[model samples]
Target: MFFFERAIAKQIKNGGGPYFRYIDDLFIVINWPVRHLLKQIERLNNFDENIKLKANIGSFTNFLHLYTENRDGTLFTAVYQKPSYEPYYLPSNSIPPLHMKKNIPFIMLLRTIRYCSTFQTYLSERENLRMASLLNKYPNKIIEQQFNNVLLKFNIDQPLTINNYNKYRQNVLDSPYKEPTGIDYDKVLFIHFTYCSSMEMFPLKFHTLWSKSFGESPINEITPVLRIRNVKNLQRRLTH
Candidate 1:
């Protein structure tokens, strides 16, 4: 596929246009008739038997989850969602830890900030996220707190203006996220136990016990990763 894309890109370059390819997705721009571009794409399609290319020619299109349009010599971008997409997330009222519940809204709010080109669009997406969170039994306070945190992260304040949004969006695009180095298993300990509603504070209690037992020892340097396992009920016990 790499070689095929390179060959097709070479062909596209001969016609003097900008072409970009990302994991089987292509974005091509040319100052020629649409029919001419289509013919060129068709020729490229014939270059390989396994790779069949389809062209989407339009002034506005969704590419890589972004709805972009060329409007009056300017480009406008917004987050795009397919018609079949549903807003479903982990229920805040579930048995997960409080941090995980808070993370649901925090991550979504960050995504909304990343993908929305304007503040107005981001506000609309935030409202949608709030509604979805409510449907999932999430507290409204958590959603609002996360939203405010995102605004603070981006240095956005009340009476938001397009200039602020444009600056924030540009800053985000210029500095794409780099995935942080994952946990060091060598420096961690895994502790697992059966989970119950009453054991919600087990982690904190365990930490306190550890500090009293080994606070001065080298073992204290190792992080303890606590995990919970759901205990099976009578129905599942019989089935298993």
Candidate 2:
């Protein structure tokens, strides 16, 4: 990908528009004429037998999860989901870390806010998110609180103004993502299981056994953490 991108970067830059790529997905905004651009793409596809380019030329397009379009002279963007996209989330009543449940709404809202250029678009996506959360058995209070927290963190007011939206979106783009902290794999032990009401005391029993079995050994120094490998809902099961 590095070599392939570099090969075409010069031409794209000379086209006087922005170009972005994340892994194999490429989104290019260029001013080349239709025939010229098609011809260029044809050459790129034939450049390698293993690589093929599928081009869509239009005023509106979807790339990755972003729906971008030209509205009058301005470019607008919103969340893009495929026709088969389903609103599936981790069921609130299911087993998982509390942090995962809490993080879902806030993180999803942040993604929606970043992609939506207008307040109306953000509201539309927010409403969809609210519905999805409800279907996944999440309490209404939790969703409301998470959404409020996101807006508060980004310094956005309700019924967002055009003036405020511009600033809010800028902050989203300008903010740098956090680097992942390194984990000490040797000092930690992970136990994966599917939780049920019957096994409520199993964790405590296991810990007690661990202390008794390894109390005087060096293994006792390691920490044990429980993890739910995965939860299969109807939608995921059907799809898989």
Candidate 3:
């Protein structure tokens, strides 16, 4: 996940101009200035490495891998996707590699939610209806309330059941086919995709949403790729 962020950031920094890459799948707005896009491609080509982006764009696969190859000599590789299966493909060269830190499970959950949003339009109406039911059944406000109530009760970040579990349980029991309530899954997806794409232009807004959603000082952890220095950087690059 971090690798995808880094790669997209790298693209924008080098004039790749912001795109999403998940495993072999890639998504880009493709409305950037041609010169900027070209310069990014040129910069990538000049490197002793070849960067390839791929994605299935459907099925929402078990996981995704971000693959890279350095043509100069050895390869620099990173796996952004968590493994869902084994027999993990071994590199032929038997090259031991440096490891990248994985984000916490909650962070992963946030990302998965955001990623799912990108394809909201692509989802079948039935699927969306099902998701809507799920969200309506377990709305974000409810989820946040549940999380907070539990947090306060336990005085720790460790997982715990919400005080209203029985109520939620009863609701579920009463309407087994009904989806969760109060969750704006559609809105969440729309907001996340728009924010990520425009973060370079709206640092303040992006960070604001990030902070609110993740419950932390956004700047401290939300490092935009290209190593965005500050809001000024985002403003300058976006307008330029």
Best by TM-score: 1
Models sorted by TM-score, best on top: 1, 2, 3
The Cα local distance difference test for each model comes to 0.79, 0.84, 0.39
lDDT of 2 by residue, 1-240 (tens): 667778788888887778888888787777878899899899998877876767677789998899999889899999999998999988887666556787899899989989998988988999999999999998999999998888788666674566677777788778788899887999999998876556657778899999999999998999888776556678668998
Cα lDDT tens digits for candidate 3, 1-240 = 455356566655676444655564555544465676666556644443445433223222222433333435643332344455332232222211111111122232332322331222212322332343243343344334433443353344443234543343233234434566674443443223322223435646665666677775443443432223323356568897
| Global Cα lDDT for candidate 3 | 0.39
TM-score of 3: 0.19
Error of 1 at 91 (Å): 1.5
lDDT of 1 at 47: 77
TM-score of each: 0.75, 0.72, 0.19
Badly placed stretches (over 4 Å) of model 2 are 1-6, 13-17, 47-50, 155-163, 197-225, 231-240
Residues 148-192 of candidate 1 have per-residue lDDT tens digits of 776677566653466677776676567666799798988999999
Residue 61, candidate 2: alpha-carbon lDDT: 91
How many Å off is the CA of 74 in candidate 1? 1.4
Supply the global lDDT for candidate 2. Answer: 0.84
